[model samples]
Target chain A: MQQQVDIGEVVLHHAADAYSFGIDPYFLLEWHAWEFMQLGPFNLTPTKHVIFMVIAALLVFLTMRVAGQKLQQQRANENAPKGFANAVEAMVLFVRNDVAIANIGQDGAKFAPFIMTLFFFILYMNLMGLIPFGATATGNLGVTAGLAIMAFVVIEISGVVKLGPVGYMRTIFPSIPGLSGPGAVAMSLFMAPIELLGKMVKPFALCVRLFGNMTAGHFVILSMMGIIFLFGHLTFWNWAIGISVATLILGIMMLEIFVATLQAYVFALLTAVFIGLMQHEH
Target chain B: MLLALLQEAETHGPNSPFEPEFGLIFWTLAVFAVLYWVLQKYAWPAIVGATEERERKIARQLEEAERMNAESQAALDEHKRLLAGAKEDARALIGEAKTVAEKEREGLLAKTRQEQEQILERAKREIEAELGKAIAELRRGAVDLSLAAASRLIDANLDDAANRKLVVEYLDSLEHSR
Candidate 1:
């Protein structure tokens, strides 16, 4: 008898956040959500994505802490860092100089820590999904939205701090050049919603871009893997298809790694740009 | 078949990626907040501070190196200038010494020549005087011999002063003729 493979079920099961961790036919660890704390309108249950998020956070914190310490030690010794510390330093400097400072101008260094944290945290979360028995926390919409919302808050707050309340209002209601009186006022009124939408869109794009890229990569890999088992019988064609699909999946996995890093960089870069734009409105 | 699969995926209602799970968002916020707070409190300061310090140190070192290079170059230029001045001074001193030595040698040579000429003139005057005296003595001896022969011939003594005067007049005539 040919085994039935529900491709959609397999893909959804792997791609979506779940309250249980499963390796399928080998091991399964299901969580009882009711056992966890329940606040008003909030369930503090540890889902697969949440657990992965913690792992990612812990990984980032510990690694960065070590890197930070090593950096301090290297500074004290007045010598360059080596190996992992060096790599971390390079990344930190890149985010500081290229991402944050490059986008945000002189005051960008103040925002470097936030940008660097977002980058590494998102990076680790994206990478975790590729590992066996690991789920991508960033693949979840809620997680990406949370990150985006935080970034949005930072961007807007920085803008507010840099440009006073009146100046921030001017950002929404920009003065049109060469036009004054009623014309400029009409232009400002017309541009106001657009400016506000533009503000919201920056973070929205950051959220969806990251979430989509991560989730889509996993979907493609799972769908490709599903193709091999789609044929009912184990034949020569099936083995050939399996081999081809595996190769394709490997290629995609490589691309996914690149995409993960790219998405992380994009998010950080866009956030920096938004902060910069807010600081310097014209 | 793919469309059917997608439709089937859509049927799994709660699993839709678009569906916002408040629990997951809350967890994300909590985790991210904690991570951010922890990192901001500890890791970021060290990393950023160290990196900035390293940058400042590198810039300072470069500035120091440039300054040192300029200082060394200036010192080298000063040293060269001093060396040139010393060389010029030494050359002038040598030239002066040569001129002084040349003048002193010329003066000593002139004095030595004058002394040699005077010695030659004195020796010539002395030889001439000695010759004149020898000649006078020889003439006196000849006259005395002549007088003695004459007296012997005459076989008598004549007046001494008159005879002497006669013999001197004869000898003067004979010397004049020779």
Candidate 2:
């Protein structure tokens, strides 16, 4: 009996990233956030989320690299595409044709790599959460924020590069004809902050939407687990509740699979759209 | 003061799920950067390039097929035109042969008519010459017979004057009354 209780506690400890191990003192920062030993001055602590993120990244990289090689070879041999190479090529075409090019127009090819990387990275991260004993790195606010920051940087830089500095500034702060020095200055001052806030809001939406969606799915799955524990004490009701809970959890898991891919597509697509908006001045 | 407060917050726990951690964000950015770099270098270019190339090649092939189809259609039309012309030429050739045959038949008819006319004229001339020769011979024979009869009457023993007179009278009567 005591051994089962200990095992349950250990399982819960590993499941929640926000919680510490074994409910010892709940050392908030020290344990809640993953911590590891340092070499010299740099802290290189590999958290569960970070580890999964790396795995997802590696999975995406290796699969795509292999698929890329096969596709190139397929071209050289003039053979019909088949198998994993065929599947990955379809996805690559969809990302390029439907998502990237559809949103970004002619210059879409230039940003195809970045958008494809973002898409596959998020997709793998979302799918990783569904695996046994796997945690979703995208569920982490910090990670999503980081991704959003990267998108934001790309958006801003491409805007400047596509439209020269003056053109980009004019898009943000338009000049009105027949307005003298004072009025022009006043209008520019007024619109500049709003435009800046608008630019920041797009990435903020990307971050919160991805983080909230991923976290919600995980939270529901965890809550379902919690229900099983809540009914554990009542032996009579436990079995009945366990069956229902398991069914409900299975349904949510299926829904999460769809949500995961949808969220990843949304993130990448919106990033492309935002970048495209900046690429052309109205 | 802000740095000191951040240090203090670090010592404690995150205020909420919204709380951002330096290490997590830094690592996320670092990892994503590496992913982007690696993918940008190898995966993206190859995949996009291959897909575009395939699409372009397919379009080119389709265009070539369409052009070939059009050329074949033109060739078929030309063949049909040639066939129709050949049929027309055969019809004209048959008509020309019929006219030529008709002219030859007419010429043969006219030549046969002319030859019949020439043969009739020659037969008439040959019959006329043969009839004239027969009339001349018959006349000569009749005169010889008459002279012989006259000589026989005189030798039958009458006076020469009386016989001569009788014969002369008879000859004159035959001449007058005969």
Candidate 3:
């Protein structure tokens, strides 16, 4: 019973209203739908993660929209981009040149917009999580899975579109060149399911990797802070926990920031590669 | 109400970490799709197009600048070539003028020397003829004096006019026969 209570308290403290300093923005927002306007039949309540996701989405939209306008207005000039425009443009170019072109080849230009969208969107969502009041949407498995699903769809579609359905199937199951008749047939049949599962594994890895990294980092930070609460009665122990673990927590927070950026990059990079790999066999 | 719902969500399952909520997935997909569509439609093309256009423009400008530089260099080279040709032509003209001047000086010297020589020869011939005339005049004067003396010695008492006339006629006949 004590263990259960401790676990519950820790979960509530970490995942619920963190710090209780009113820094938890979720508590500030009203969750009740006025009258009969519930979201779904499954009693789906809009969580803080959803709100943060929307905020991230809006941020991406507004930035790109403004940058797009700036780009349009300055179309004729030969000067470099400046300020916020410059920053966004650098990221866009990075995704286009390094990520998209390097992976997708000549046909990469067609998908630059989509790849750019993915990179900036993921980057914004990741970075938002590091803020005081913000929660990482990507920390949620459902969100990461959704993102992975989108990437998976793009990869599969590009593969199917570039290589016909027959060719796409052949990508999964290859016939041995020298083997004739039943042997090659048996080999292909044997490899088909495995190859299909291999395709699914890419997105699954992306989902789990992002979710795990983000969740683990936040948990470590929360757990480190929980140490002070764990030894609240012992003043010396609380001071020691505060002094020692506080530094480590700060370091980990910095690391979390880095991981946020890195995971975003990884997600975007992998998405580009997956899409590119589908289009080109090599 | 929101806090109550959140508390409900927080306690729905202790293993909430592993739970994949359909609502969140649907919302994420919906939100991301909308964002992607808005960006792709209104933002990306413009941003990317402008950037590419700017890049191409810069490349073209660089190429233009390079081409202009090359053309200017060629022009300078041509100018240098023309100047060199002009310098060569001037040198040749100076050489030709020097040679012509040298020929003219030589011709003038030769002509002046020939004129001097002709003048000296004419002066020499005139001097010789004058000297010969003077000597002949002196000889004639001496012969006339000697003739008078001889005539005086031969016939002091004789008729002077008749004797001189005879002598003169005799000398003239002798000169004619000789």
Candidate 4:
């Protein structure tokens, strides 16, 4: 049976270049505070909290890298991975093989660096959304779209690289360029827009997809919490029953773990596919 | 959707950073650089180094132990084979010596017995020669005595030849009867 969990809305503002509220693109872009700005326009916008996340990201990168480094030691190959490093390599290889390389290709290994990075990055960002007083960087479209744009750039550049100067346009369309039967022209015209739309929609789709999912989960959790307060004013019975919302909220919290990993995976997988598409034909 | 969302957001308020254009670009570049630099420099290397080092060390140790074990087992097997060979060699040597000693003893015994038989046979031959010489001498003595006795009994001038013949006949008769 499917469980219906309803979540409410999150208000985001675009009022200023340097908005201070959470979950807003304006704020994310404007994140640097005055103190951090003194260093030649470098963003000092990350709050101590954002700084914490930065720190967390750093730790993740370091931990994984160190593990990878040790694993790479030449003689170590004889023994194979062990302990924590074993576990970590297994995870990395699994993700690389099953999701990235499988969907992508051999050249896809290079993108493993990007995909793995994004997976952890987005995963942490999504998880950070749940923490009280924690900023969900993912809630902002600027961040998500920025990520999506990176994918777009990589994908387009990769496609161009794969198809080359003369063949690129041809690869995008089904028909030969000069042949113009009325049906052919019509078909090309129709397909061209659809192809254009498809290309344009990819990043936008990714942006909205990730943004909706992350934001929705948070809102659902928040709404469940709001229920207690929403009903708290009415009756003793309402207050008591509303307390049960805590359990449901906890349940959602658990579900958030699954959602977080899944979103991170989908995002990374899509990135690989996008990157892979550059080198590969339909 | 971002544009639409922004347009809707525009309805909410008069905004300063009105567009995502340069704002996102600048921040993304900034954030990515900073994160990459900091992580690659201070954080990533260390953590990756540690984990990889750990994995490598564990792997190395396992390999070392395995190699050592194999070497030891090989040495043990060699030693056992050597020991067995040595034992077999010792037994063979002992058996060989025993055969050699038995052949020597038989040869020595046969040599001594042959020498003893030769000495006894020579002594018997010498004694037999001496006895034969003694018997001849006795016969000469007997002839002299008999000649003296016959001369006294003959009464002087009887013919020596006749006496000699009588003596000879008597000797011959005695020999036949004996």
Candidate 5:
């Protein structure tokens, strides 16, 4: 089905049933009420969701493989590292030492491989959206929220192990040390709901933040690009203006690329932080 | 709250505006597991192996450096030993030369003293011989003078050998006193 909308207004995304408009400044907010990929039986009915996930995974693997091959060739001298390998090495070290280790400490090292993988995986997926007909997997709340829940589960499990049963309860109730009186008890009681909210808020915020940043950047670039199509087939003014606009959009697109990578990094970083906080006293 | 939102999105149902999402949980799990497995197996090993190789190379370089340092130290010690031995040999040669010069100086001094003593002895002998010859000649001359005086004074013929002998003896005594 085809429909015509306003000329100046932006069309953020086009899906099967409905389309989205530009809103939520940070990320393009869109949802499909239906399942695109239907799972086939003995697999007769296949769903678009599964297809999308597989495609996302493959793209991630290929990009990283290209990067990994480049890394090895650079390391042959091993003493002298160069090019993409150097860039990748620098990123790995930063995430490993500066972000992961610094935030998560010794216990966090176990998750380093997975966290690094997640960052690269999300990063590649978000970048693919710039291509024609590609979807942003990270832009979906269901996807981001699901990933957040995994982080949540890991966080809870890690906290439980570190804090023990009584210690985990005490975390939810942080009364001032050496307070045993009724007033102290009351204050602890008052803080419980707020602490609970904060706990729930962590994953919600993570979902929104990743989804928003990735989708918003994509939407803006798409809208800016729509300017070229708006101009007619042949005219000198159209050429000048269209070229200039396209250049501006490309410049903005470069900024979006940086943001795409950074958002992935931040998501992983915050997940580490939340987990670490749970393991620690404060 | 869940039913209401699901219903509202569904109400626009015709070319059904909102289509229900089914078993996202199941496919999501499968894809995620496959992703985790593939990544763990294929991608990570390459990176990890390369990293280990780099580390090994660094370690080898360090070991080589240490070996070179030790070799240099041993060479330096050997060179120092050779230099000390050469210095000792030079000192020994200098001492031997000094002793030989001292012996030569003592021999030259002894030969000069012996030659000087011989020259003085010969001059003394020559002087004594000359003195003896001159004394004898003087005694002979005195005897001759005394005899001539006696003959001129007597003027007669009756003098004998005894008289002549006495005159000679007297002249010898006179020469000795003078």
Candidate 6:
């Protein structure tokens, strides 16, 4: 009897975060959850995603640092940067000009660094999953949520600074034109929760959009590949199916790479837009 | 297969995508915070500062170029004005010189005419005086010849004063007749 392969289990196992880092078929580094660092409801354990997150952070840090030094040197000599430094400068300028200032207005220069950090960090995390034996840190809901929350904080704080306390309150409870007395009060009370929900939804959308896109791309690729193993035995039909699916996977991977870059851009762009929205009330 | 996965997903609660892991979130926040701080402090300043510096340098250079252009333009205008003024001055000088030369020529011509008139008047006066002298001398000789002729004809000497008076009267009569 041929044993059937459970594609669902395989996909879920690969998509989800694990304590073990699997390098190859034989090499696997198992990590035990840190029991002593349990504080309240949280267990601070080093997982696969955590390791990748650290790697991504380190990469972003080193790359930016080197690029920054090169830029400073080039500027001193009154010369343009070349190669890797130029590429990094291009990205940095795009985020500063197109994403930050374009959306967030003239005052967007202050938030450019934060937006740049988010963009590169998310980009690196997304690309990590595409490589062999590497996991996507951004694929995890928690990580995306964390990033979204930070963006949310920056957005709201920018509003508070721009609009002030009273003006910020007015954003949530807006006064309609030509409405007076009790009617205006009633309307303001009614619109408050909706306005607050609108604010919350921006970050929520940012979080789910990144997480869903990254996870779904991986899921589709894995499931398609798993289809070849469905036959259980290496028959001619199975081999043919495997070759066909592998070709399809290649195409999907190209799309995934595009999506990875796109999602990072979208996240940064939306965050800037949200910050811009907060700067001025409609 | 979808149903089977749903059932399996329901059983596997911890590994589910919807389930939140506090530890993962904590780590993410920690890593991100460190990244943001480090980058904001060190990396960003160098890159962004250089960009701003370059922009400032370009702006200043443009301003300087504009200033130089304006200055050169003003200088060119002044030079053109000076050239026009010099041309005008030269024309005026030539016109003045012509007027002076014409006046000097007229003055010289008038002086020459006055000197020519004076010389012609003196010559006329001298010629009249000489003509008067020559006529007197000729009259004296005519009287002498007449007396000698009369003496020879009469073969005697007559009184001179008496004959002279007669001769003078005869001459005066002759002059009146011509």
Candidate 4 per-residue lDDT, tens place, A40-134, comes to: 64443433334434554765666677676666563355766677767766666666667777877877655655666667777787777666556
TM per candidate comes to: 0.70, 0.63, 0.65, 0.55, 0.57, 0.72
Model 6 regions more than 4 Å off = A1-3, A76-78, A232-234, B56-178
lDDT by residue (B51-165, candidate 2, tens digit) is 6777779989999999999999999999999999999999999999999999999999999999999999998999888888886676456544544566675456656566556
Cα lDDT tens digits, model 6, A103-158, are 99878888888888999999999999999989998898888988999899999989
Give a tens-digit lDDT track for model 2, residues A217-242: 87677767777776666768878888
What tens-digit string does per-residue lDDT give for candidate 1 at B1-178?
Answer: 6686557656755445555578777877889889989999988777777668777899899999999999999999999999999999999999999999999999999999999999999999999999999889988998888788888889677987899899999989988999
* lDDT of model 4 at position A267: 88
Cα error, candidate 3, residue A115 (Å): 1.8
Please tell me which predicted candidate would have the highest DockQ against the true structure. 6
Candidate 1, which segments miss by more than 4 Å at Cα? A22-26, A74-79, A232-234, B1-15, B56-178
Angstrom error at residue A166, model 3: 1.6
List the candidate numbers ranked by TM-score, top first.
Answer: 6, 1, 3, 2, 5, 4
**Which of candidates 5 and 6 is the stronger one according to DockQ?**
6
By DockQ, the better pick of 2 and 6 is: 6
Worst 10 residues of 6 chain A by lDDT: A230-239
Each prediction's Cα lDDT score? 0.86, 0.79, 0.77, 0.66, 0.66, 0.88
Better of 5 and 6 by TM-score: 6
lDDT of 5 by residue, B111-159 (tens): 8898888888888888888788777776667556666667667844637
Leading candidate by TM-score: 6
On lDDT, the candidate that comes out on top is: 6
Q: Is candidate 2 or candidate 6 better by lDDT?
A: 6
lDDT of 3 by residue, A135-246 (tens): 7878778888989998999898898888998988888887767987999999989988988899999999999999889877877787676666666557556677678888
1 versus 2: better DockQ goes to: 1
- Candidate no. 3 TM-score: 0.65
> For residues B5-110, could you state the per-residue lDDT of candidate 4 as single tens digits?
4565565432212333334434554565566555455534333454446657998999999999999999999999999999999999999999999999999999
List where candidate 3 sits over 4 angstroms from the true fold.
Answer: A1-8, A16-27, A32-45, A71-79, B1-11, B54-178
Q: Is candidate 1 or candidate 2 better by lDDT?
A: 1
- Tens-place lDDT per residue, model 1, A14-131, is 8877778778669988876674478776667778888889999999989889998987788689987788888887888898899998999888878888888889999999999999
